[model samples]
Target: MRRLHTRTARRRVVGALTAGLLCTFGPAAPALAAPAPTVAAPAAADVAPTVDDGLALTPPMGFNNWNSTHCRAEFNEDMVKGIADIFVEKGLKDAGYQYVNLDDCWALQSRDANGKLVPDPVRFPNGIKAVADYVHSRGLKLGIYTSAGTKTCNEAGFPGALGHEYSDAQQFADWGVDYLKYDNCNNQGVDARLRYTTMRDALLAATGTTGRPIVYSLCEWGQNKPWEWASDVGHLWRTTGDISDNWGSMLSILKQNLPLAQYAGPGHWNDPDMLEVGNGGMTDTEYRSHFSMWSIMAAPLLIGSDLRDASDATFDILGNKEVIAVDQDPLGKQGTVLSSEGGRWVVAKEMKDGSRTVALFNETGSAQRVATTARAAGLPAAGAYTVRDLWQHKSYNTAGTISATVPAHGTVLVRVSTDAKWAKNPPAVELGLDGGLLVEAGKPVKLTSTVTDLGRTAAAQVSVKLSGPAGWAVKATSPAGTHTLPTGRSLRTTWQVTAPKGTPADSYDLTLKASYRSPTGVRAENVLPLTASVVVAPPAGVSSLGDLPWLSTTNGWGPVERNTSNGENEAGDGNPMTVNGVVYAKGLGVHADSSVEYYTGKACETVTAQVGVDDEEGDDGSVAFEIWADGTKMAASGVLSNAQAAQAISADVRGAQTVRLVVTDGGDGSTSDHGDWADAQLTC
Candidate 1:
């Protein structure tokens, strides 16, 4: 059965120019002292341009076609023209959307005679340059798609960037491609950084000859934290699995991108894939929440819905200026969940202006009043502030604390700013298990503490204190904060603890005390509670008799099946046979008679046998057994009497210490039944 690899919608944004080049460019205005563009030059050294360079250029915002087109790969001139016209007509370019991208399946199976990559004749009869020209005419940039692996999503079977990175890159550049979405499929086990770098270098090489800046979009599916390394290679790297139209899939994908806030900035970002905003899987409220969250995450605002006939609601979601501002904010700090209560989640992002943006989301199935507080977000004491609802376009001067009723599977985003005297100290210490709370005895447990510096950088010192029953002992302790815990950095320590021999299965608590020097040089204390548990030991051994390791010999006889055949056959005539042995009243008893069928010159003959037991290790004797057929005992002492005709055998004995079965050939040594034993059994 074929299974689909779930794709995450996010893409990694590589270096500044590399990053900017990957995004859609609105009509270029006069240069505003922008950083020198670090065009990727195809040098033989194989060195990568820094991520700083990629993020310094275009900061990635555009429209993608997948969510709108779905699996329909017939991207004809009319389709391209229609979408490009809408982008210009809707004023989306002025709203910060510039790239009109075509997703997978647009390529023909083979390249042209000129050795240039070929677009499908049926889909692009007028050629890619025509499409590029039209999109450019609309003052918008054009992006194309390809696979890093050997096949495109369309399965049209085009040559991938596997070994021909340079050629493929040149081909795209020669086609006047402004953006390249290099997908990861069919390319298994390739080093992510190297895989992406190869393409980035190729694009640079291609762009060098073409003298046009083509944005490199790395779509490795965030196998590695491309955000951390993608800035050096491409414009955007997907951060999660591909998104479905369903809200569950969308919210789940959004939640996964929360921890990656530190890596986003101008020109580089965590792509949550494309938008499914206009899809019918969710309500308008949910889409608004979706748009709001993506904007706050600094994710690439790639609208995946059809733009030509978007509903008013779709346009409203795409045109939410306040939310868009937060996304395009120069500071580019991604928002993260600060706290959660039931289905209500509170997320926050710190802006460059020293203000904070908070989003209260209700992911549950019903509406919920999400309460917000300064403490939950690691802010200073709560008091007075100015708050604006980004989606509602309304402002209110309220206290430091805020509360709002969020619709089901929806979110309310607010920007908070204040001129009040805020505390410069780190928030109350929060502790976490570096690995996990559960641990095996004698194994080391790593603990971590998050120390936040409200505004000013503060130094934090953390120490763990253990208190348990009399038998419990503290194995070792690392110095307090000897491991530097920078502001917003976590301090970690490994504690080695051993359980006492008689330790019972119970829970034990450990208190972690964290003290810190505030920016004002004042010392304060915060305490965290942690727990650990002990488990029961394994049963005493019966000498190698533990859990049944193999499935074949464990319980009752397994059914004879094609996969595990155990039947007597021509190929396996002399193989050993196994039977369920029964022990009764300290003696061996043959529950059923044993018999073997053998072919003697095309004539079948039946055989019978007798068995006995002998006990040597116990007061009761063991068993010695044997089988006989055609007036001949199979064997008395470790030998088979009938070497040729032997069909089956059985054995029964009592008070015996040990039992041994011997095989004896019959007088007639016929080759047809020369060696065969169908089945055997022993019972006591």
Candidate 2:
């Protein structure tokens, strides 16, 4: 399934190459399937109990060492103990985190002559029991990993507990192991349920002797529909495959886990793999969204970053107690989707206190206002409801409407309840732009930001200010401050913003902040951030777009390549840019959900390109290409497959300041969706 034990650089490269080869399957089916209909819940008496070991009543919150160190030498007993120490010192333990879990590669290649597992001396010199005792001393639990197959997933092929389930379980019990993350790898054709159940019985028998319950985590990669049968076998079963630390990977896992809410409850969960919060593969905003969605789905909160050297931003995200509370709610209910349309999603989870935590998520490339009423979020009717913004840690009283302008790949999480104390914090303000604004470098543009008071109270000292990066100029054309902003009233402020000449092409944050005082004299503030891209005008004559630098780019795999086809899932691994037996000298090669933008300076007329699934994918891959001018879709290539010829695209870009080349997985998951823009040209 997911092998992460390559010790050498060459082996890592080979692993990437092998993944690329595996992606060369037949064309994927249409991606646009109807969303799963929400199923009504059964009565408490009708529901069957799950692995009732009294462990992991909520999804496990802990640290797993697989995502950061893999099989590196740095992953030793000292590192594990250090993680435990950090858990306590850094307030993670106080934040409800436990279990210092170790993944594979901690065991020896072969068992001893007594048929007992042996810890790697280099990795655990004092042995597994010593590490467990140390973690226990720190008031945390200890978890160890092994596969159900004859060997583990790592390249070293460490001994597994397949035929030795009882013996291994007893050994773990003797070592005071508190959790067992049993994986599926080289399973020897055994049935998943049978194998996992064997471990379940073994653990139970072992607990009979030691009187210590071990939380069982089943990591089978969802190949066998574990959620349908894993409830009685393990505490948490992986609902999808392994997760990588990227936006696309996280989004894919979220999609896979969102619809399986009915299968989760007390003592059992549908895990979408571990958290990649500080893995460095995604931006902080995206990581926040990742953590938010997982908490909404009630998945495990196992930290996957190296705690020994994590950033403060990462800790801030992981340490968000409000978000963690949603995951650890005593009700043990997974969130159900309220609505999801056009990359905007609203999900709500019911808490033990009769409150609902609603998440407004934006999955598109631009900021959009996502809205849902309190009723839609399953909140009861009241005179007014306290809307607690979990991310901003602000509270406001809302009559019914709950909305926010969410940034691209961002989430606005709020808890709706009748709690009166929440009403004392502030008033809710909705922020938005008059329309999409795209400006050329060195050019001044007037943009209007609308601030609407959606709360029950009027706001005094209301002021709106727009700010950009250094070297950029911003001046408000309207009044900078007002005496009072009544409820349901909106105040508009226009600001003239100018990007400095020769500004590099990149996406910059332009924040619109509104500050006011509530009726109770509480200082309330709201900030909405949107991206402003600085674009470069095309040359005087027609030129290959690949020859020009882009404002920004996002690819599903590897780095977007210039003048080459997307090769293996690594940088500089692309082949010659080719499609349908035709080779082009210049263009971009990218994966699905990829977008590359360039400034046109409102001078370019027509943008033309030959687009299709890259020939490297053979007869596989399905994708659609679109040309976007400013914020409008100028042209689109309806779902094209690698089996088809290249499709020509020509979009009118007259009076457009920026142009974007976009590739999407054709209504399906982004598997083998290698797309190319061959001979892309911009006519100025």
Q: Find the candidate with the highest lDDT and give its number.
A: 2
The lDDT for every candidate, in the order shown, is: 0.54, 0.82
* Count of clashing pairs, candidate 1: 90
Tens digit per residue, CA lDDT, model 2, 1-684: 243321132233223221221111111112223311222323434333446757789889999998888889999999999999999999999999999999988988879999899999999999999999999999999999987766666656677677788888889999999999987654555666778887887787777778878999988777678889988889998876567777767887788899999999989899999999998989999999999999999999999999888999999999999999999998999999999997899999999999999999998777888999888888777767899889888678876789988998899999999776656757788988765556678889888888888887788899888889988999998887788988888898888999988887778888999898988898878898889877655788899987888877777766788888775356767888778898888988888768887878778899999898887755667999999988789899999998888889999999987788989878655656889899999999
Across 442-553, the per-residue lDDT of candidate 1 in tens digits comes to: 4444544333322224354544444444555554455445423444455555555555665555556555555665445566554444455554322222211111111111
Off by over 4 Å in 2: 1-50, 420-423, 435-437, 540-542, 567-570, 577-585, 598-673, 680-684
**What lDDT does candidate 2 reach at residue 449?**
88
Q: State, as a TM-score between 0 and 1, how close model 2 is to the true structure.
A: 0.87
Clash count, predicted structure 2: 3
* Candidate 1 global CA lDDT score: 0.54
